[model samples]
Target: MDQAETKEWSRRYAGKRLLRSEILLDDPLFQQLINTSYFTPVPSIVRNYFQTQCQRCGNQKRSLFGSIPCYSCGNVHVYCRKCIDMGRVMTCTPLYEWTGPEMDWPHHSNACTWSGELTEPQRKGADCIVQAIQHREKELLVWAVCGAGKTEMLIPGITEALRHGQRICLATPRADVVQELLPRLQQAFAKLEIQALYGGSRDREATAQFIIATTHQMMRFKHAFDTVIIDEVDAFPYTNDPSLPFAARRAIKPEGTTIYLTATPRQQHQMQIASKKLPHVFVPLRFHGHPLPVPEYRMCYTMKKDLATYRPPKAFLKWYHRRKHPERQLLLFVPSIRLAEGLSEQLSDILHDCVIQAVHASDKGREQKVQQFRNREFDLLVTTTILERGVTFPAVDVAVLAANHTVFDEAALVQIAGRAGRSPNDPEGEVLFFHDGKTEAMGAAVRSIKRMNKRGGFR
Candidate 1:
C-alpha cells in the first residue's frame, strides 16, 4: 500500500479491535490490508470442538452458547448468548485488530485547566493515582466517602498521563454518570479532545486520547487504553455482572494501570485489603469537611398498605410537613417503579403547591426530568435505586419510603442517604428512612455512616 493509504487505514484501525463486518470497506480492500500485515484476524469464539468461549466478553458458560443455522457459511454455528446484545459472536466470525504502528497521541505541557485546589484528603488520593500510573501498577482501589471530591482527585493523575502521551479511559456502569462527567471533563481539559460514549451515543466515530464511557462500551475495545479508571466500581451492574470486569480487563494494555473509584467497596474488596493483597487509598471525608448525614429510622407500620391504597404514609407526611428545612428539595426513594409512580401521584395530591415527578431506569425522559429537578423545576422527585449513586443534588433532603424492602441493601441504603448533605451550604440536611420495620440492612447502613463520620474526625 502507498504511504497515504496506510495513514488513512491507520487512523481508522489504530487502537481498535473490530469485527470484520464493522469495517467500512469492501472485502477486497480489507483483504489487501490483511495481506500487507496491517490487520490480524482473531477467532471470535475459540473452541476445542466441545467447550467454547467468547473472546470479546469472556463468556465461557456452556449454557450461554447456542447453535443457529448459518446463512453465509451454510452450516450450523454456535453463538454466544451472553453478549449477543452488543453483536452476535458466532463460531464462524473473526475479530480484526491492527498490527501496525501505534497512534501518536498529542501531549500538552499543561493538560489540567482546573484552577481549584484539592483538599488534603483529596490530594493524598490523587497522589496515589499518579504514582500508580507512573509505576504502571496493575490495580489501585480508591475508597472514598460520598461527596469526597473523588472526580476532582483524578485530575492530577489524568494530567500526568496526558503529559506522558498515554491514553486514558474513565468508565462507569451507568449512562447518567457519563452524561454528568462530559462537560466537567471538557472544561477541565479544554485543550484536549474527549470522547464521551454510551449506548446510542452520537460520538462513536471520533477516537480521542481521553474517553469517558460506560463499562459496557469497553466491550468494544481490546488493549486500547494505558490507564483505565472504573468510576462507581461498587455500583450495579458492574459489581453484579461478571462481563463488565472482563471487558475492563480486555480494554487495558497488558501492563496498563487499573484504578477503581468507589464510595463503598464490596465485601471481596474489603477482604483483599485486609489481607494486604490490594493496594489502596482512603479519603474518609467529603470535600466540604462535614460529617455524613446519618439516616434516622422512622417506623411506618402501614407503609406497604398505604402504597397499595395509593396513600402517603402518615409518618412520612408528618416529617415532610415538620422538616427543619422546608425549602430544601426532597428525594423520595422507593423500591420499585410502580411505587415510585404511585407515590408521586399521591404526594402531588396532598402537596398541592409542590411540583413532583417520578423517574426510573426505563423512563424515556429520565435525563430531562433529572436536569429539570437540578434546575429547581420540581420540588420532589420519586425515584428508584437508579439515582442512588452517580448523581449529585445539592441541598436536598433524602428519604427512602421502603427501607426495609429486600432491594434496600446496605450499600444501596448508604448511597441513598449520601444524597443529602452534599452541598456545604446545606451540610445538615436530613436523611430519613421510613419503613414498616427496621431491618439489619438499615442498621448496617447507619453504622457505616457513623464509622465514616468518626474517621472524618466528627464526634
Candidate 2:
C-alpha cells in the first residue's frame, strides 16, 4: 500500500481495534476521534448495536449513532434524533467487555470487623453466596428479610473474589445506596483498591479492583469486571430496564459469577426458584434477632369518598401525637408527591420547632434532606418510596399513609417497614398502614414478615 493508503488503513484499524472494555471517555485519541465529524459519537451504538433505544426514554428513532445536542440540559449526547426532539438524552452508555485476556487481581483485606460474630442465619446466607461463587453460578437468589445483614453475608464471597485477585462490581439502583454501601464495603475490603462510582462520585478516573456503583453508572463499564453483585436486585430502574441485566451480564467475563441480593424477589424471580432454574437461599430474619414488625392495616375510608378532602385519620393523628418522641425521628410514607407535600404542610402547622421535610424522586434537595435526616436536623421526613431501601434512622417510628395506595406493593411495603427498628438500641417499632381499604399486598406483606420471623425463630 502507498503511504496515504497505509495511514488510512492504520487509522481505521486502530479505531476498530480499540478495546471496548474500557468505558472511560478521557482517552485523548478516543476523545479526538469522538469529536471528529467523520466518526459517529454514540458510544452506545459503537459498543452495542442492539441497544439502539434511548437510555433515558427508551425511544427508538433516528440512528443509534446519530449525534444530537440536548435542548433541555444543553449537554451533548449520542441518542436517537427522536429522543432529542422529545428533549431526552440517553442516561446510560452500552459499552461493555464480554471477554478479554484475564487481568491481574489485587490483594484485599477486610476492614470492617464483624460488629458481632455472625449468627447461624448469617453464616447460612454467607455459605450460599460462597457456594455460588465457587460454582460460577449464573444466578443465586438471596431471599432475606429486612435487616438480615445482607451486605455482611456477601463479605465471604467478595473476600474470596478479592483473595483470588478478581475484579468485582457491586451495583444498586440508587445513588444514596451506593453511598451507604461505600463505607461498609470499604470496611469489608479495607486493604484492597475500592472505587465507588455514581453520578457525583469523586474518582472517575481511578479503576479499582473492587467497585460499588449505582446501576445507572454501569453503562460506563465495559467487560471490566470478573464478578458482579446486584444488590437490591428488585429495586427500580434495574427491575424496570432489561438493558441493565444485559449490561450487568456484559460487564463480566464469560465465566464470571453473578449474585443477586434482595429481600423481596419479584414473581419472575420466584418462578425461577420454583422451577429449579436458579439456586435460592433464604435468610428469613434480621441479624439483630428480632421479628419483622407486622404493619397493622387501618382504612381511612374517607380518603376515597372525598379525594380533595384527604387528611390523616384521627386515630393516626392521635397515635402520632401520643408516641411522638422528641429525640427520635419519624418517617411518614405517602403514595404521591402531592400527598407528601400536603401532609408536610399540615404536620408543620400541628408541631412547633419540629422540622418536617418532604422528599421525592425529582427533588433537587434530596441529598441535603438525606443529610439533614442523618444529622438529626429533621424531626420528621415525609417521603415517597424513594427512601424505601438503603436508609436507616435509628429509633424512628414509621407510618404509611394510604398504604393501600397502588405504589405500596408487597416488596415495597416490606422494605418500608424494614426502614424502622434497624438498630439494636431500638429493636422494635410500630408500622401503621393507614388506607381506605385493605389490599392483598398488605396481607401478603404482613404474612411474609410473619413467615420469615417464624423461620428465624423470632415468632
Candidate 3:
C-alpha cells in the first residue's frame, strides 16, 4: 500500500481487531494492507483439548458455544452465543488488527472548559485520580455518595490524560448512561474530538481520541485505552455478568489505569477496602453540600391491592396531597413494567390537571420520555429500576410504591432515593418508601444513607 493509504487505514485499525468482512474499503486495498507486515491475523475462537475461548468477548463458557454448519469452511463450526448480538464469532473466522506504529494523538493545552468549581471533597477525589493516572496504577476505586459530582471530579484527570497524548475511554454499563454523559463531556471539552458509541449511535464510523461507550462496546476493542474510567461500577449487568468485566480487562492495555466510580460498592469491594487491600478515595459530601434525604417508611398494605383494582394507593395519594412541594415534579418508582404503565394511567386520571408518563427499559421512546420529563413537560414520571441511577431531575420528590419488593436490592434502593435532593436550590426534597413490610434491603439502604450523612457531618 502507498504511504498515505497505509497511514489512513492504520489509524482505523489500530488497537481494534475486526473481521476481514467488516472492512468497508475496496477489496484490492484491503488485500494489499492485509498482505503487509503491519497486519496481524488472529483466530476469532481458540480451542484447546479442554476448553474454547472467544477472543472478542473473552467468553469461555462451554454452554454458550453452539455448533453450526458452515458454508465457507465446509465444516461444523462452533460459535460463541454470548456475544452473538454484536456479531457471530465462529471457529473459522479470523480477526485482523494493525500491529503497526501508533498514531500521534493531538495534545490540548486547556482540555477542560468547564467553568464550575469543584467542592473540597470533589477536589480531593480528583487529586487522587490524577495521581493514579500519573502513576499508572492498576486499579483505584472512587467511593462517592450519589449526587456527589462524580463526573465533575474526573475533569482534571481526563485533562491530564489528554495533554499527555493518552487515549481515554469512559465506559458505563448502560446505553442510557452513555447517552446522558455524551453531551456533558462534549460541552466540557468542546475543542476535542469525541465519539460516543452505543447500539444505535451514528458516530460509529467516526474515529476520535476520546471515547464514551457502553461496556458492551468495549468487547470490540483490545488493548486500546490508556485510561478506562468505569462509571457506575455497581450497576447491573456489570455487577452480575462476568463477560463484561472480562471485556473491560481485555479492552485496556496491560499497564492501563482502571478507575471505578460508584456510590454503592459491592460487598467484595467493601471488604477489600476494609482490609486495606484495595486503594481508594472517598467523597462523602455531595456537590450541594447537603446530606442525602433519608427515606421515610410508610405502611402501604394496599399498594398491590390498589394496583390490582386499577387505583392509586391510599398512602401514596395521601403523601401526594400533603404538598411539602406540590409544584415540584414526582418520580415514582415501581418494580416492573406492568406497574409503571398501570399506575401512570390511574394517577393521571385522578390528577387531571397535570401531565403524566410512564417509562421502562423495553419502551422504545424511553429516552424521549425522559427528556420530556427533564424539560418539565410532564409533572409525574412512573418508571422501573432502569431510571434508578445515572439520571438527575433537579427538583423532584421521589417515592417507591413497593419498596420491599425483591427487585429493590440495597444498591437499587440507595440509588432510587438519591434521585431526590439533587439540585442545590431544592436540597431538601423528600423521599418516601411505601411498603407492605420492611425488607433487609430496605433497612440496609436506610442505614447506608444515614452512615453517609454522618460522614458528611450531618447530625
Candidate 4:
C-alpha cells in the first residue's frame, strides 16, 4: 500500500471514476492501486421496481429497463436502455471510480492566448464566471440570446482555470456543435492540451487540460473536470433527458463549478431564476452589437395542402422573386424531411435557373449539401430544423415555410432566425415566417427577439 506506487495514476483521475473494464493500465498495477486506497468499485446497475437505478446515469425509469441472463452471476439481470449505447450495465457490472488523493498541481499551463474582446454584456457575463470560481459556486447560468457569443464569454474563466491547473471540460449537446467549435477552441487555447472527443475522434489520446465533447461523451468521465461548462444546455436530447444532467454532475468533481450556457432555458430554470435559486447573468445582445433578427409573420394559407399537391407556396414564390435578384443565400426551413424533398423539387420546377437543395438528418449527403451551399453552389437550401443551430452561412436570408407547424417551436424559430444575421459584415438580414396560420410559438419567438432588441437599445 505504498502511496508513492500509485501516485502517477491517481494524479490523472483524482476525483474521477471509470468502468472497471475501461481501466487501461497493466492489470497487476491496477489491483495494486485498488489495494492502496486509490480506487473504489461502484455498482453499475441498481435494482428494484421502486429503487432500480443506474448509478452511472441516475436513471430510475422502468421504461429503460431490460433483463438478460447474467453470464457472470448466472441469474436474470436488468440494465438501463437509455445509456445502453455507451455499454450494457447489469447488477454484476463493476464501475471502477478513482477514490484517491486530491489533485496536486505539478505544472500549470499558461492561460489561453485568445486575444478576442468581449462585448460589455459579454464581459459582464465572463466576470460573473470569474466571481463564481472565486466563491466556489456550484452552478451558474449564462442565459444569453442566440448569436450572443456564449462561447467567447467562457474564455476568461476557462483561461484562469487552466492557469490554476484545474481540469476543465466544455460539453455541448450534439456532435455538430463539437465539430463546429473544436478548431476555434484549439486556436484560442493554443498552449493548452485541448482534446476534442466526439464519435470516432482521432485526438482522444491527448492528455487534455481542456475537453470539448458531446453530452454522450461526458458519461465516460466521472469527477474528472474541476470546471464543467455545458453549452446549449436547453437543446434537444439534454433538455429531454434527465440522465444527461446526471452524467454532467458525475463528470465533474462534486465541489467543482458548473456553468450552463443557453439562449433558451427550460421552464424549470425560468422558475428557478424567479425564485432566486439559480444565480445567472443575461446577455440580450449579440456579440456584434446587433439585434436578433426579428421574424415577420406572413400568412400563406394552405401551405401543407399546397405541398401535398406538389405546389410551392404562392406567397413564398412571390417573396422569392422580389428577393431573388440580389442572389442572397436563402434557407427555406420546412417542417419535415418529406416536405423538404417535395418542396425542393416543386421549387426547382418554378425556379429552374436556381440551384435549390434539400437536407435533413437522415440525408447521407447532409454535410456535403451544407458545404456546397456555403460554397455558393446552391442559391437556396430547403432544410429541416437540423440546420437551425451549429451552422452559419454569411448573409443568408431565412424563411420558415409552414412556420406554424408544431416542429417549428420558439427556440427552433429563434435559432433559425439567428442563422441570418450572424456575420458582422452583413448584420442586417430578413427572417420571415410564412405560415398557414401563426401559432403561439411563432408569436412568442417574434416578441422575444423584439424584446431583446429593445433591451439592447435597438432603434
Clashes of 1: 0
User: Which runs in model 2 stand beyond 4 Å of their true positions?
Assistant: 1-101, 107-116, 305-310, 322-328, 352-354
- Estimate every model's Cα lDDT from 0 to 1: 0.89, 0.72, 0.89, 0.82
TM-score of each: 0.95, 0.79, 0.94, 0.94
Distance from true position, residue 353, model 1, in Å?
Answer: 3.0
lDDT of 4: 0.82
In model 4, the number of clashes is 0
Candidate ranking under TM-score, highest first, comes to 1, 3, 4, 2
Comparison by TM-score, 1 against 4, better one: 1
lDDT per residue for candidate 1 within 1-459, as digits (tens), equals 687777767766776777877778898988988897788988898887677889888888999999999998899998999988777888888888889867777777688999999999999999999999999999999999989998899999999999888999999887778988999989999888999999899888547889999998898788889999999888888988888999999899999999999888888998999998999998998999888999999999888789897788999999999999999999999999988888888889899999999999899999899999999998999999999987888789999987999999999999998889888888878999999888999999999989989988989
Residue 90, candidate 4: Cα error in Å is 1.2
List, residue by residue over 112-171, the lDDT tens digit for candidate 2.
344547778899999988788777777788898889888888888887776666778898
lDDT score, candidate 4, position 136? 74
Better of 2 and 3 by TM-score: 3
Stretches of candidate 3 off by over 4 Å are 1-4, 25-35
Best by the TM-score measure: 1
TM-score of 1: 0.95
Superior by lDDT: candidate 1 or candidate 2: 1
Error of 2 at 45 (Å): 4.0
